[model samples]
Target: MKKPSTDVLYQEESTYVDMLLRKSWSMRIAETVAFVLGMMILAQFFPSNDTTFKVLAFAIAIAVVGLAPFLYKATMRPVYKLTKTHLIVSISGKETSYPLSEVEQVYEGRHFYRLGGKKESLMVSRQFLSHLNERLFYYHKGNKRR
Candidate 1:
């Protein structure tokens, strides 16, 4: 088989926050079930007045939907990008170039890349990566030795 092109390999952005926030296959199902059950429970407690029931149900419905996006963002995975000119990190928009004699390593972690150096390190996530290539990433970072 032909070697996978570096350009193709690094096209997608995988944010830690995104992944974490995604309702798990099971969680989505559970949420649906809970919504139904909660509605039923609340309905039983509803005032005999139809208006009161409608208002309470509407409020609960709105609150659940409103919180979904925030919950997803909080739990979702972070993001990063690897391009030829520079390694663009998502969280902070930091980009580091390759070929620099100083950068000691590049490795994947749970939600970010660890770029090691004698003095400090650079960490990037999916949010930082943009459309680019590995060569461009190296060139942008000053073409330092890998």
Candidate 2:
């Protein structure tokens, strides 16, 4: 057996929101279900105006298809990997590595921790909240000793 090279300090599984954002099939399925239910309701109330209902349904379907990519990109969830020397963020199929030394601020919130740096900010989800706190303490303590 081969030993793993990199040590993973903390890992979080994909959340429900992450799945909805990252998976195209999930999003399309959800949109289709919603569209069908909406059309059914519209048909029930406005049965006489078949043209209006059909036009509305068609327009909504087009909008859903057009906006799918945008929604997926906008709501992308970053997978966080906290290591000894760096924080790895995977979002939209890209992995970005940030050195721990560059972390300027760690803001603790009720649900998440905002790790801010010079270039960008990363949100550490609640699943890794405790690990985030521990890392923040270690970083700040090292700074104080210097």
Candidate 3:
């Protein structure tokens, strides 16, 4: 298939996010689950004759809960954009554009497209799945690789 140039990919307007709609609410809920599990695990050690283990677990759980929000804030969310010829991913503002010709497969995950081979895969949300199918169908059909 034909490859798109870097210039065209970088200049494209389409940007999509893999993040769920609830945003922070969803993330916090997941983190809260971890906090509950950690507390349960700590509870197992509470009855132990060894006091140090209990104290350590308690301290660790508290520390994790306290730092959870800050850690989530510090984490970098990758940005994805689809151009006429390339799949672009940006993390911490650094953009890397991959030619759409390299997309060997389109359907993998439910909410995201696993764009790349086993060595390293970029996850772009399925928001562009329909357009991507439209763009790449000709290439795949031309070569009978679909």
Candidate 4:
């Protein structure tokens, strides 16, 4: 489908998950502090003379630190902009547009509203769309099932 040039009727600044993702730096620092404290506790259980235990603990710590950034990226949610005819999502500085006609379903979940399509789905937190919730709710009401 061709991209729509319409202005956004509603926009979500950031979802709860996205807020968490944006705090990755703080999370990583906390993780590192916890890892150090955990290692200190584990050190008492394993004797200093045990080379194998020391090597294993060191390896695991390294792996955890190395994978932290990737885990943060995986948890990020895209920014969402909803227009009359399309939904635009921006992830990692890239924008993708999907026609609203392709949206198969809209449902309110416990923490977020889910918009599902044939190949893609978006989870929109209520907190992020607090200002435009009423408008979005009414607009998608017809698309929702009983």
Total clashes for model 4: 0
For each candidate, give its TM-score against the true structure: 0.36, 0.46, 0.46, 0.43
lDDT of 4 by residue, 41-130 (tens): 778788867986688678768766665544645655457787766667786768877665454343343323333434333445555444
RMSD of each: 12.4, 9.4, 8.4, 8.9
Alpha-carbon runs more than 4 Å astray in model 4: 15-77, 106-123, 127-146
For candidate 2, write residues 27-135 as lDDT tens digits. 6687888778877777787764578877887877777666655565566755778776566778776876666655544334533223343433333445575675567
lDDT of each: 0.44, 0.60, 0.54, 0.58
Instruction: Pick out the ten consecutive residues of candidate 1 with the lowest summed lDDT.
Output: 118-127
Q: Model 2 Cα RMSD, Å?
A: 9.4
Against the true structure, candidate 1 reaches a TM-score of: 0.36
Q: List the residue pairs that clash in candidate 2.
A: none
lDDT of 3 by residue, 50-82 (tens): 687668777776776566644543565455566
Error of 2 at 102 (Å): 1.7
Candidate 3 pairs with clashing backbones: none
Q: Could you tally the backbone clashes for each prediction? A: 43, 0, 0, 0
